[model samples]
Target chain A: MSAEVELQNVSIAFGNFYAAKNVNVKIGAGEFFSFLGPSGCGKTTLLRAVSGFLEPSQGKVLIDGQDMSGIGPNKRPTSLIFQNLALFPLMSVADNIAFSLEVRGHDKVQRRKRADELLDLVALNGQGDKKVHELSGGQKQRVAIARALAVEPKVLLLDEPLSALDLKLRQKMRTELRAIQQRVGITFIYITHDQGEALTMSDRVGVMNDGELEQVGSCYDVYEAPCTPFVATFVGENNAFYGKVEKVEGVKVKVQTGGSSFIGQAGLGLDKKNYKFKAGDEVIMFVRPEAISLKGNSKKTQNSFSAEVKTIEFEGNLKNIFLRSAEDVDIRFSVPSSSDTSGMEPSKNVSLSFSQDNAVVLPTGALALD
Target chain B: MNSFYKKNGPVIATFFLVAIIFWLVFLIVIPQLYMLDLSFRPNLPPLLRGGPDDVYTLTHYKHFLYGSETSKDAYNYVDIGVFLDTIITAVLVTIINLCFCYPIAFYIAKLATPNTARLLVLALVIPFWINELLRSFAIRILFAGEGVINNILLELGLISTAVNFIALDIALYTGLTYAYILLMIFPLYNALETLDTNQLEAAKDLGSSTVRTHWRIVIPHAKAGIASGSTMVFMLTAGALATPVVLSSPNTYWFTQLIYQWFNMNDNWSRGSAYSIILLVVSVTFVLLMMRLFKVTIGEVVR
Candidate 1:
């Protein structure tokens, strides 16, 4: 039901501005792949290139080991669900779903029967006679999916299709979308800026920035070990400390920063992914909040530091305690809200600690936000 | 009206409401009533016009359908024929204007760059700044004997003889279509501007060919605009006087030209009022039929 999609140095340019610059990646058949980036990062451009709405300025887009050059969007065996869920408002639900088949010269009976089957598949059964406006936002998305599926496309492309939905429905639809994709067994290329959606739904997530693919890997791999400064900050929240590398020992490096020498597992600090590094290199160590713990969780082998508490953010199950060292270097860690965090108050002093393996030592690069 | 006063207080609200009523009655209602009254009276000479002798009759209306049968002269089939011709031309003009304007409007709204779209709108508008009468005469000059079109065709050897476009109906439509085309383009542009480009892409990705995409998606979404533009163009083309008078040859007449002749040349204000009323009725019917056909509500069409 699905096929492999590959991009070979694909670049899309609008006159002189590069919307997508020299991108290369491979998506497996039946793989749920998502391109994660902020707005204007050219993720949508790359998706459009695959769907045939955009032609790459430099390289090739291939599907199922076949070159897709000179092919129009209609001639390709693919379907795109739009950001706004572009369901046909004028047509009945059945008609909107059956439209792809209708244009293929199918009779009304066959179209109606197929539309009804899809209606049941999308869980909107017996609601085929209603117009698109009569349905809720989630139902409209289902209709759009049903319509796209009616063409029996081997690859399904979605351009931020769930953006218009509210948080509850969006979370709900995320599970539904993954289920539908699995049931259909088609290659799905989803484009969005929300890393939560990309992480939750995609088997593999491609982090894009400034018209470039920063990193492409499994959700856990990218979130756990981001390769670029942009990816580390953009993919999820991480507290960073700027420093210079003091020494490299095997796969670990010790960074001297803000008058404190911190040790970390060396990863992700190079001009290019393949570049090597040495001592005295300027770097930033990024640590996830979950990686740091209160002094109780710190083992004898870990390093610890004392800092004054600045703010306490109480999320339902976890309390985020922001701390600042004597040198004014800021760091934060999340502790289980039930674990006696009552003392974690503003202006209160506390000790934070983490193992060297959890802190990623990378060459200083761009932060997620200015 | 009471709510209006409640909302804004008594004095200013009453003044505004009464002014609106006064304007409607004095400007729109009174003139329409006067025309209706005049239309029911028999046609009389200029000196005997508005006399007490012949009034309150259906004779003028009957004369429009049967062409003054009580007269001691040849049967004037021209009036009734032109009346039908006016309707048919109005419909044809509407259709033609739609065909010409839809693609341009869509391009401007959805395809062209914003600057290009602005320039194209200006292109549609700039010619109208030249007085409409002069534009109509320009059409006549272009299509008349030994005019620009004739000279070009002669030079290209497409035809050895000069084509008298004025005698043909083409000249009148060329002018009227030009006159009313801007009216068609604007509404369609307004409607199409609201369409999401993603919808068009989604249709193509759903395996719809270009024509099918427009047929099932674009046109249905733009029905209100289509209805609005078509009705306006049809009514205007049907009631237009300058094009037929300036561009038509001898023995050719438009319904407006007949109204003009009845009022001015024939010295029959009653018959002319009847003709004007008939044009109004036909125009209203066309508007309502367009609204019905396109499934557009009054508010949607106006919007």
Candidate 2:
């Protein structure tokens, strides 16, 4: 029902300034791909370029192998749901959904029938005669989706459609949006600055910074094995410890910090010679909060450190214990509230350990190493 | 109560009341009441204060609506031609200005680049800084028979004889309406600019072409502006005096030219006051009818 999209080394420029740099991405058919980044990071620009509002300054934007150059937005087999939803306030719900059909010169009866079908598709059956403004926010959101789907566009583009809703409603819409996308079986290209929205719904996400794509991967790779410091800080909360590479043996590298030595796995494609990490070569260790486990009355892993608990953050199901080592290397360890858990008391010394596989040694320059 | 009065409260309220009373007597109520009285009296006798005998007569209105039999010429008689001309000219001017101004307004509102839009708006405003009469005179000079236009035409071999450009009714209408083109554009620009561009994009993304988008999203949203601009252009062109006097030949006259003829040429203030009242009623009626037809509030149209 939907066609795939491909952007091959595409770049967009405004006079001398590049709004989107050489970006290459392939969205396969029926994939819920998301372009995720903060505002002004060129994700929306890239989406607009794909939608034919903006023409790429370099390379090609192809829809299923057909070049989209010189094509206007209306000519494209793509539909975009604006951030404001952009529903026609003057029309009834049915007319708003059947707008594209009317443009295509379909008769009144046929357009109405198609509108009714789309209303049912979005679960607003029998409500097609209601005025657009009469609908609630959620209903308007569904109408926008139904209107976009009425044209049966090969690719549906959604630009921060849920950014205007409250947190709880946004979450509810998230599942509903994903479900609707799945039911329609269209290639949905969603754009959002919210990392949670991307991770929860996307088949894959392309993280953008400035005007360039920083990394493209599945949610797991983007969150865990982030190739750049920007991605590590952006994808989720991460605690970083500065260190020096003391040794590299096989797949593991031992990095020495201020008051102790910690071991972590070296990244895959980083050139070792480029880093030239001899003994005492500066490096940075990136660790996730959940990866650090408290070793209470249990045998520790290959890497363990003694740290005094500085603060306890009670997050309902899980408690995040903030620990400080002798060198004052503050670290966080997430412990779930279980029956066997030894309740962590603040200011108590505890041993927290994580396997080298869980920690990654990122060569210096991308991040500051103390 | 005396203490409160001494605390500047009574003084402030008294001053405000006095100001309102003064405005009512001098600015609004007095002139209108005077005009109403004048509309019922004979021209010469009322000007001479012929006492109670001159008060309360339907003679001026009847004479303006149905001409006097003793008059040798109908043009000399107070006839309904002026009223009809004023309405027809105002309607035509409104239509003409709307056609010329809407596209420019849309470009400034929706499609123009930032700097270019600003420059275009600035260009529109530039001609207004000079006196409007001077501008009209400048147009006259360029088109006059012995002026620059005829000379250029002669040089270019386009015409062998000088053309009398100002000896036409169209010149007066064109000049007067063009003077108020900017006024029509401002309200339209404001309305069109407030429309959501994303709505247009959504329409386009839904397979509507540029024309369809303009009709559905752009025009409907610009209703308030259109209504407002129509009111302004009608009121202005209907009540205009200077353009016709300067540009029109004596054979063909605008309605305001006739009203002035009553007040100044014939010194018939009673007939002029009746014409003024008729003009006011017609303008108000047309505006009300338009508002009702368009389903827009007067406040929305004005603001």
Instruction: Give candidate 1 misplaced runs (Cα > 4 Å).
Output: A268-276, B1-22, B43-54, B69-76
Stretches of model 2 off by over 4 angstroms after superposition:
A269-281, A297-300, A306-311, A321-325, A328-330, A337-350, A365-370, B1-25, B44-50, B71-78, B149-163
Task: Write the residue-wise lDDT of candidate 2 on B86-165 in tens digits.
Answer: 78878998999999999999998889999999999999999889887887887777767788878999999999998887
Q: Which predicted model would earn the best lDDT?
A: 1
CAPRI class of candidate 2 = medium
lDDT tens digits, residue span A107-180, model 2: 99999999999989888999999999898888999999999998889999999999889889899999999999
Query: Chain B of model 1: TM-score?
Result: 0.89
* Clash number by candidate, in order: 1, 0
Best by DockQ: 1
* C-alpha lDDT of all candidate models, in order: 0.88, 0.84
CA shift at B73, candidate 2, in angstroms? 9.3
In model 1, what are the clashing residue pairs, if there are any?
A269-A363
